[model samples]
Every structure is written in C-alpha cells, then in structure tokens.
Target: MGRHSRKGPKSSGPDIEAATADAGADREAVRPVPGTGRRRRSVEAPAGSDGHTPFQQTGHVRGGHPEQREPGGGWGTGLQQLHRGDDHRPGARPTAQQQAAAGRQQSTGTRPLVPGPRREFVDAFDAPPAPPAPPAPRGPSIPPPRPADPSTSVGERDEQPPGGGTDGPAPAKDGKGAKGRTFTGIAAAAVTTVLAVVVAGQVTQDNGGGTTSAQPSGVDRLGPDGASRSDDRPTPEPVRAKPLSYAQKMAKAYPLAPELKASGKFEAVPGTAKAPGRGHRYRYRIDVEKGLGLDAALFARAVQETLNDDRSWAHDGAMTFERVSTDDPDFVITLASPGTTGEWCMKSGLDTTEDNVSCDSAATERVMINAYRWAQGSSTFGPDKLFAYRQMLINHEVGHRLGHDHVSCGTRGALAPVMQQQTKSLNIDGIKCRPNAWVYPPS
Candidate 1:
C-alpha cells in the first residue's frame, strides 16, 4: 500500500482537481439558484417560542448568528429535554430568586439546619421564638393546719362544750354534723321506743284488769217501794199457740228445707210475719220484731238454696229461725227494735208499762241482728250478693247446729263451711270467699 501511494501522489492530485471542476460545471448546468421575492413562513412555532411570535428563519437575518437570535422565550431546547414532562416547561430557566434559593439549599447540604421545629408559614414575618421548656410537676399543696394531739384525729375528739364555743381554744370540727344527726336519730329512736312501751303497757293494763266496769243501763232501777229493783221488772208475755209444723206454703215452694231429709234435720225454718197469716198447719204468730235485718223470706230462701245445693255434697241440714217477741228461748233471735214504748207486742199479751223496752231476754230465742244496720249502708253488695252473704251467715250457724267444729284455713283462700264460727272469726272482709276460690274442700 505504501509503494502504490508513492507512484500516484503528485500526478493524481491535478487529475482529481480537473474532475471536480467538471462535476461542478455539470451541477451548475443542471440546477440554477432562484431569485427570491417573498418567503413562506414555517408552520410549527419554534421550540421554546413562548407560543407568541410567528416562526422565523433566523438564518435570513443579515450578519446575525441564528442560534443566538432564535425566536424563543422562557427556557430553551436543552431545558425542554432535561426537564421533560415536568411542570416547569422544557426551555424554562430559573429566575434570580430561584437561583438564589438553589444556592442557599446547596450551601446547607439539604440537612435542616433549624435547631427545632420550623415555624408555620404564618410565623415567617417574625423571628422564631425559643420553645418553652416543660414545667416540673409540684407535689400536692396543703397549708399548715392547726396542731392537734398526735394520738387522735380531730373527729376522734369530743364536741366543744356549749360555753367554750369554737374559738381559738377549740379544735377543728370534722364529724360535728354527723354526730349531731346521730344524736338526733338516737333520741328519736329512744322516744319512739318509750312511746311504744307506754302504749304496750296501757294495752296490757286494759286487757289484764278483769272487771268490766258498770256502764249504766238507763232503766228504772228502783221500784215504788224505793228498794233497788234491777231484777224486779214486771214481765208478762204469752203468745198465741202456733203449731209445731212444716214451713209455710211459700217456704215449701222454694225448697226451704231440701236438706232436711238428707241430714235428717231441718235447716230452713218458717219465719213468722209481723202480722198473723192464714195457714192450715200452724196459725202463724206475729212477733213485733220478727224479720228484722234482712228480707226474712228471701234470707230464708237463700239458706234453703244453699242447703239444697250442698245436700248431695255435705248433707248439712237446714237451720230454723224464730222470733223473740213472746218470751226468751234458749238462743235469742233478737231484732233491732227501736221505740220508747215498753212492750214486746201488745197483741202478744206483753205489758207496755216501762219507759223504754229493753232487750227482752225472756222473749229471746236464738240469734239477733240490728235491722237498722241493714237498712243503713251496712252492705253495699246487691240482692244476689246479699243473698250470698246471708247464705254464708246461715251456713255458719248451721255448721254449729250440725256439730261441725270451727276450723281455720291458716293460709288465705275461700271460707270453708267448717270455719263457721260467725262472731268468733267473722272476718269475711279480710278473706276472699268466692265459689271456686274456696280454700278447703266441701265438708
């Protein structure tokens, strides 16, 4: 290759120059440069052109370097490539303020040089104040108190004397209010106890004193001879004879003695009217105070009904009712007789010679009821209810007549027939006595 280069160097230079001239002549002959008049602008704006000026060929400017005088603003092509897709545009360049900020950051090496937390943006106008150090906690505070005996708290001490009061000489009061309340409560309890004891003692005295003091019975206690005649009252009563008989026809109509055959004894008795009535078997004797408290016929009917209903169950007998107008029998069926006249009845051959008629013990038969009590608001229960009540009363008396002993349910429930001691335990108001609610079985 060295030998071939030496043979051609001088000669080959002139020949190559002649061929280049010929090729230039040929290109000149093929294409001529245009004589330009008006030039069309480029369509796309120049890169980094700030989106304003039309695209200009910077080369057309006479004697000007195109790169130095390019139609651009903000930042240039190098920045556009470097910061591609960033919010800062492609050719955007840093302002003096940004350059200063960058210089400061570089000097600080990016480590936060602030001694503590940076102030908020609002605190930027003022110098940052030093942070306050946390306060040390103090122990619970208490003032020095007045001295007391080491052995006891203030409450352990007694209350101040009345005259001494609570001056400097007195100790602090801790349980003063509590002590007062305690004393007050104890005194009240003691007073209550004393009152209870006194009441109990009085009650005992009332019960224990055997004698029932005489309550004056307002009557003539002296006779015409001026001698005490408490037991010397004239007595005269003899009623017309009434037959020992079956009950009246009305009584039989309502089965007044239905249990009579069952128990082999009579329960529903014939009640005499206030006036004599015609009947075949017995001439009815009229007693002045005969059917007193209740509708005597209706009362008798209820008793009959109860006897009839329970005959198959208990076989209890009917009970007899009589009057206390003629003379007192074994049990006095006394009525509520109210008058100033002194007589059982004028027709019954009894004397009407006293100021006030007393309970005619001689005319008494068995039971007594205050008719006035019934006439008043003694029972608010209606006819049927009263019938039930009267039936209860009859059942009570008949229970005794039937030789059934009184019994207590001990637990609360309906009244049992055997529990029929009327006056002894006649507390119907306190206990329930409905039909199905009976506590004990039917006798």
Candidate 2:
C-alpha cells in the first residue's frame, strides 16, 4: 500500500497524481504560504484499491493543483506566490514577466501585487520624461509686461509681439513704461495739490479783512519822511481831524438869538461817562432841543466836567455825577431856547419869561438851561466872562434841583452863592457881589 493508505480513499487515479505533482512543484518554487502552519503532502493512490483519490473526499479538486483550487487553497495561495516572485533588492528593475503578471492580475479584477520592502522599481516605459530647463536670457532681462487696462478698447491695447505670437505684450525695457506713468501721476497730483493750496491761501487772505483790495487806493506816493515808496508798500492810515482842546471849546461861541424859539423836541445825547470817584453817585441825562444850533456834545461835555469839578457840587468826593443816554437818570438836564425854558419853568409856577432865564422845573424831570443864556453871555457876567457865566448858570439851576433856595451876598463884595440867581444880577437889595460858579469855590 502507498503511504496515504491509512488516511483516506483515493478516488481518481490519473487526475490525483497529476494534481499532486503540480502542488509539490509549486511549494518548491516559492516560499511557504503566510498563514498556513503545515505544507500540503502528496496523496498517493492506494494499490489494488478503489480509483477515487482520498483528497476528493476532503473536497480538493481532482485535476487542479492546491494553489489553483478555490478560496482557502487556490486563489489566495496564487497571490502569495506572485508577491514572493518579485526581486526585493533596492533599485532593482522589475522583470518583464512580473509587470505582465501585474497587468494580467489587474485586467482580471484581482488586487495587484504589492512589492516587498526595500524594493523601489519604477516602470521606465510608463513614466513621463522630465521637462527641459528654460533657456537663458539673450541680453538684459526685461520686466514682465503690465496687464492691459480694462478701460481700453481692444484696438487701443498693445499690439502682439512680432510674428503675431501669443506672447504677452513685449516686456518694457528697464520697466520705464510703468515707471513713466507712475511718475506722471505723481507729478500731476503734486501740481494739483499746489494749486489747491494757493487757492486756499488766497481765499483766507480775502476773508481775513472785511474788504478786498485789488490795488491799494489812496496810498501816499511818499512816506512822511519823504522817501520814495513802492506800490507794494503798506497803505497809509486815514488822516483824522484833531479833536478840539478844552480852551478851543470854551473860546468858540455858538449862534442863537436870546429870543429865538426852537422846536421843543429834544434828543438825549448818546453816550455814557462813568463817575470818576467813589462817592454818592447821581445819574443824569443830557438833552438838547432840536434846531437850537448848539453843540450838544460840547454842552454834554461841559455839564459832566463842571459837576464833577472839585469846587462844584461833587466837591472833595462828597458826591459824583454820571451822565447816561439810555438808563433812567435821576434827572435830565435840558438845553433849550428861552421859550421852551420859560414854558418848562412855568409848570413849576416859576416865571422865567421876565428874564428869559433857565430854571429847574420842580414839577418835572427836566432841569432847563436857557439856550440864550448858554450861547450868549449875560450883561451881569459879560461876554468875556462867558465861560464862567455858563458854569454859574448850570450850577445855579442844578442847585435848585438839589433843594437849595434863593440867597444873596451879605458882605459888601463877596463871591455870590452858586445857588443865587446870578443870571438876573450879582446884587441883592443894593449890595453888589462877585460871580461864583461852584458850591465849594476855590479859596
């Protein structure tokens, strides 16, 4: 009996022998299979026994080798042999048979064999060739051309390179084309900025002063020192008239007849003069009757100066007087014609028509100063004494307003009281007295 006689019945005689021979040859041709612990043994036919092979009862195919059988023994074992057949040396080329086997495996929808470790083979016939290196530049390298402006029409865009090739517009030499446009844009902006600054400066100059001067008018051709002047020289200030001095105001006589009747309408002198000292202050307004031909400003000035004099009612800081135009004043000192003065004084039951004199209208806010007495001097205090006479008149009338009454000189020849009706006469009951203009007359 054969060595397999104890194992199983041998079914097919010739087929089993042929399959056993092929399986033995395959085991010798390759390394051991990865997972299987034992190798396949050859099954011999039993001598003088039935013809069925024992492997047939084990489900092994009759004519096929174990590697060619289904599943567990056939296809899986074939794949392992394919992997083992590859040469695993570094950089070794794959054999033509190996590549053909891999292609065949792929074509059959089988997984392609993975090469073993340390084997790195590339199929030269299948891999693409390496690209050639770019050519060196002929001369100086040029910068790439700038993109065409989207705003430009196709015809206006840069022409193609010579020979009509699809190369970009020819590169600019030294990048001067792009640099020139950049420089031009910068220059234009700088010029625009300068112009804007110039215009703004001109506008500021014009607005600084209330008026604009194309060329300076009324300019002096020469300076005060007689040097020749250029047109660019600063314009000269206007020539203003010098203000009148106190003596000049005093010396000037205004024209108004003693009996001249004026329009009774009066206007308050427009200004304010603050009292000069810390004293009991009395605020007063000065009003001049219209058409009196008097210098109202001069009269207002005289009243302020006189009342504030050290010898007058404001003596020794005992009292102060402020002249105002707008506020409610303690009293309004009015310079009016004799008719207006007499009319105002009559309201207080004082008959001033007999002497055409000024009076304090006790019944009203006005303290009237006769324009005739103010403009023309009285016979008692003649024209040469006009300045003193005017002062006396103002003091006497204002004194009455301050609650003083008529009084006369007691001595043979003494300065009359400022409250005296000095305009009528400097004498009372046959005794003559000198003129006085202040309550506290100078010693």
Candidate 3:
C-alpha cells in the first residue's frame, strides 16, 4: 500500500500525476527499522473520498499506521470483524479454510489482513424454518406381572401381594377354620361373664346384703383355734333385762320365816344420807344381822327416806333424820330375824315373840325391827297395804325410840297414829281405824 498525501487536492489531471509520483517516492522511502525487521510507517488522518477525516470515520484519532486495515476504510471495520461471528449467514456452518484462518489468527495474535467476501444480509423471516425437534423419546412401557414363587417367604418375595394379602394357603371354602375360631372366642367370653356373675353373687351372700356391714375392730373375726368364724350372718346383740322402777320395788314383798333365827352378828350399812331439812336433826345407824339374806341397802335407804319424810316424825320441820355409819348415833335401827328380834326385844323387857313384832330395845341403842315383819305385812295391814305397812313398821319402832308411846284412834274410820302399834292392831278396841304410815297423814 502507498501512503496518501496530506495536501489539498489540486487540478484533477495534475493531481493524478503528482499522486502517482508521490506514491513511488513513498514506496522507496519505506524501510524496516533495525532489529525489528518490520517496516515502520507514519499514519496520517487523510481525508476520505467522502471528504471526512479518519477521526470523523472512526470517532477516534488514528496514531501510527497499523500493519493492515480493513479495505472499507477506518479501523472501526477491523474492530467490527473481530466481534462479528465467523459465519455471517444464519444456520450456516464454517468452512475448513475459515476455521484454519481463525486458528492462525488466534495463534499469531492478529486479525486477518484480508477480509473475506462481503456478507449479504438476509431477512430473518425469509430464512428457512428450523427442522421440527425430533419427538421426545417415548417412555419404556410397563412389563407384565410374573407368577409368585411358593418357595419364597412373604418378606423375601420381590413383590408383595396387593391389599396385604396373606401368603399362607387360603382356608377351605367349607368355613370350618373360621367357625372353630369364632366358637372358641364366644365360649371364652361366656365363661368369663359367668365367672364374674358367680363371684358377685357369692360376695353379696357373704356380706348378707348389697352393702357390707363393718365389723367392730375390737372383735376377733377368727376363732381361738384359728378357724374363720361365720360372718355370713351378723351376730345377734345380747338381750338385757330392764331395771325395776322404784314403785315396783316398793310394791313387791320379800319372803322370811317368822320363826327363823339368823346369825346375830351385825354389819353396819355403808354410806350416809344427809338430813334434807333445816330442822332438829336426829342421826341413826342401820345394822343388818349377817345371814339375813336381805337387801340391807334397800332397808337402810327406806329407813332414811321414811324418817325424813314430810309426813313422818319430820313433819312441819319438827325434825330431820340422817343415817350414819359411825358408832355414835341417836339410835341404831336393827333389822333382824324374828328370833334375833325376840332376843334383842327381851333386853328392853318387851316380848315380840308372840306377834313377831318389832320394838325399841331401849336398854340397848338398837331399835329392833323383825325381819319377818319387815319382809311380810301384818294381818291388820294385809298385802294390799304392804308398802304402807312397811313404812308404819319403821316409824313405829323409831317413834318408840323417840320416846313415843302407843296410841289408838279415838274415832272409827280415822287414820291411826304412826305410834299406834299399827302392825299389831289398827282396829284396837273395835274402833276400826284406818291404817296410816305417816305421823301426820294427809288430811
């Protein structure tokens, strides 16, 4: 190539001849630099045929000349080719020559000095349609099922039977196996139900009712011999007799032989009864002979209660009687057998053997009351008036000890005095006085 002149063009004929001569001179002046062995050329931005500078064509200043340039003009063409695809036509394959040239360009680190044939532009719509993509390969079809092996166990088998089917030999269509299992299960359940019912019934019977009775903890459920005592029936409570009332006790009569003699030894009745009134108090002791087989306590209580009665010697608060167990007393009221009474009465110079009567043994500190008379009512005051007769006996004997003498009723049907010896004759001299127990009987 020849270097173009930077001067303005002159007349056409002369300019052509001068340019030819300058081209020849430039060719001669071009020489290789020492050591590089390559021609060094000064590149200038010459005006193009269109009258545009190289800078105007490429939008950049051109320095020294490159070894080659694209024929169409500026270095911009070389840059475009470097970036452009090797195959200019769509869907066109690269030729062997183009491939070899690309390989050399890559090796030599340079662009092709000579451009290839000019690429003709083709419209995308006018180009041939791409071959339809081959249909996707069809998926492998399912294989046929194989028969199951009898020798293999269910777990070791390659494929399991559907619906978790059993591998064992199927039961016979006769239904014997199913029927036998169902019958066995039914029998077991029935037996269990019967056993539960039987146990409940036994427990109910043992407990005697639906509710169990709690046993007393102190009571031993087992016998001394280590045998289980029968608890099927509740033990019956022991029967206890009701106690006798005071009226019933006073109404009852006690038995004693009129002539029976008892041991003369005496035992002082124990315990004291306080005088219940603020009056002239008289203290007495009650002594019961041994072997009397009498209720000494009852006798002593009767003596104290009767003597302190409002209607007796204690009437109008004239006196109150207190029973004492001490030796010192106003008098000793003695309850003895008829014989003992007779012996004690004799000491006072009185004879009670004939009537088995009670007397105040003044010679001694004892007022003897015949146990026979104390136990049996007198004929004058018969069994119907036995309670009153017993009271009269106590008052009479005690009255005598109080220095009272026998007195008879002056009027018939009038009550006899407590000191009237009512036990012997309430109807003295045919006056027929009603029997009385109180010294001051109720009007």
Candidate 4:
C-alpha cells in the first residue's frame, strides 16, 4: 500500500503571512483590486515532494478559469508579463486579473489598451459616481460696501436712540419721568446742603481762617527786645481731656501685625509757627518708634494738618498749634507699638494688646498711640472712614492731653464729639452717633 498518510488535519495551504516573511517583509502587501472577489492564494507542492520546483512557491493566482488562461499557461491580455515565478521582489507579481490579461496578450499579439496621454479612461464597470455641481454664487456680494462712510467732514453723527429721538436717553413712562424729576430735585438739594456743611466746617469766604473766628486782633505786645510777650495775653480756657463712651470689648481683634521700630528716642515734626490771635499757640512734638516701618513724617504731617484744620482743635480760635522740637515740648505724641504702649501706658489700666486703644499717659506725659490702632481703625468706626478714624484717634488722645473728658453720643445719628471715647462704643445713651473727628461743628 502507498504510505499511510499520517499528516491528518493538514492546512489546505501555507498562510500568506509565512510566504510574506520569506520575501523581504518590508515590501508592500499584494491585494486584489477593491470590489474584485478574485483571490491570489498560494498552491504549495505536496509534503513528500522536493521543495525545489516552481510549484514549491507560496502564493499565486489560484483557481483561475481554464478559459481565462491562454491555451498553454500563457497570458490572455496585453498586460505586462509578470515575473515568471519565485521572484523575491514583493508586489512584483501581477494581480489575478492582470495575470489573466497577460495570458490573453500572449495568445493574441494585440494590446487591448493603447498607451496614450491626455485622455481620461473611465471604466464603466469600476469608476466611481460623478461629483456634484458647485454651490450657487452667494447673493449679490452683500451690502456693496457703504460708500466710504461719507468722509470725515460729515461732522459728528448724532447717535439717535432706537425710539428715533435725538441724542438722549430713551423716553421713559410718564410716571417714571415724574419720579426722575423729583429725584433730581431732591439730589440737587441734598448736594447743596452737603456742600454748605463742608464749606462751613473747613472754610468760608468770610473768614480766611477756617474757624468762625480768627485770632483776637490785639496788637502783639512786643517786648523791649521786639519779641512778642506771651505773659501779657490772658490764659485761654483749658480744653479738658476726658472723652467718654462705654468700655465695650472688641468683637474682633485687629488683623495686622506691622513691623515697628523699637527705638525709644523721639523725633519732632517741622512746621511753621501759628499766627497771633488764632489762640494760645501750643508747641507739640511727634515721634515714632525707631524701626516702626510707618512713614513718621507723613503721620506727623497728618496729625499737624488735622489739628490745624478749622474743624479741629484750632477751630474755636481759642488755641493754635505749633510743631516743635524743643527739649521740653508741651507734649510728645508717640506712635508706639502695642508692646511699647503696654509698658508706657501700663498706668492707664487698659489692655494694650486686646483693648486696641491709645492712651494719654498722664504720668509719663506721653500720648502713647497703639500703632495697631493707628494702622487699623476700630470696629466701631469701619474702614470706609479710615482717614476720619485716624483724625479722631489723634484728636481723642490729644484731647486727653488737653484735659478733655469722655462724652457720650448726645444725639442719635449726630456726629460724635472728638472728645468722645469713641474707640469704644458711642451708644452709651442708646444713641448711635456717627464718627466725628472735629470737636466743634462746621463753622
């Protein structure tokens, strides 16, 4: 018997992948034309056979119709003849249709395609469908470009409202118009009142000095040496220093931790002398902590400016202020850090740290201002009125030096007195007063 075949369940042929690796795998793969069911497969030789025959080759145009092939394994069309067999170059083999056409060409010597340029070859059997026409031309080139906007000479265009009125706000309802006119009148009146108050308080055309009264017009009693003698003038009424308000706890502590100078020395501010008759000219000194980071000059100027204002200590024409650097100044206003304030103002008996209040240390003769309070105004006086708060702080502490007593809010919503202990609550008499920096009303 012939050899009993034991190579059971054998593959019909070698996969295209194995044959692909045998060739340089870098070559492009061979594939049938799209839409063509024709397959180019491998027909391996029998297992027992020697692998040397051309039939030992891997993939080929298999299952070709005998009629499609030429009479003797030749081409049937004018396609270029394929590399006969086992050429290692990939993609060199003809497609099945090309192979069939080559066979026909070998049989008949005539070429089906005449190689010529400049002409499209659309095969009805394989060409794709025709393209669509381009979109219709967009409508008449819109807007035709406004005639160069009538040149700049057209003066400024009055931008009319959508309602077609001339340059003005759109017309409102009748009721709205009436209300708007009323509001405008009220606003104008309010503005006039405010202007009057501010003018009176700060200055008036009547008095060159902001105060209602100016320095008493007594001739300067010059000494025999020509210096004005101070002893000749009557002593002015002393401004008592005891502004009062409730001792309210701080609902919240100040948030800033500023850098301050620890230097114990004091620096005096520079300014001009007060004119005679404004009142008894009082000399004062201003100093800041050595490393206290604050602009000492600016702070001193603010204090000086505040005190010299018509609405301030000098407002009543009873006293005028002169910033001095004398060894024995009437008073030394010290901007002190919280810690320093505690030491210098310990006798004041206020918590320098948590109380956040400045003190006029009667014993030390120093107006010790808590730098924290200086930087951050109190809760009673919100930040919006920061400048006013600063002014009030200066006035209140200096009021202490001037012997002023604490005073409660005299009337609800009225401006609190400068001498009020307003760093605390102003509502001692169930009347919440607005924060005020000036002792006297607007001139």
Point to the candidate with the largest lDDT: 2
> lDDT of model 1 at residue 241?
82
Using all chains and alpha carbons, the TM-scores for the candidates as numbered come to: 0.22, 0.45, 0.48, 0.42
Best by TM-score: 3
> Can you tell me which runs of candidate 1 are displaced by over 4 Å?
1-296, 299-364, 372-384, 401-405, 416-443
Ranking under TM-score, best-scoring first? 3, 2, 4, 1
lDDT of each: 0.33, 0.66, 0.65, 0.57
Error of 3 at 218 (Å): 29
Cα displacement (angstroms), candidate 4, residue 56, comes to 59
List, residue by residue over 292-386, the lDDT tens digit for candidate 4. 66667667777777788778778768788777766677888888887788778877665555565788888876899888887778778886666
**Going through the candidates in order, what is the number of backbone clashes in each?**
19, 8, 0, 30
Model 4 reaches what TM-score against the true structure?
0.42
Model 1, global lDDT:
0.33
Model 3 misplacement above 4 A: 1-230
What's the C-alpha lDDT at position 415 in model 4? 86
Model 3 weakest lDDT span, ten residues long:
29-38
Model 1 Cα lDDT, one tens digit per residue, 99-152: 233234334544212223223423654757878989866733223335543332
User: What's the residue-level lDDT of 340 in candidate 4?
Assistant: 81
* Model 2 misplaced regions, further than 4 Å: 1-244
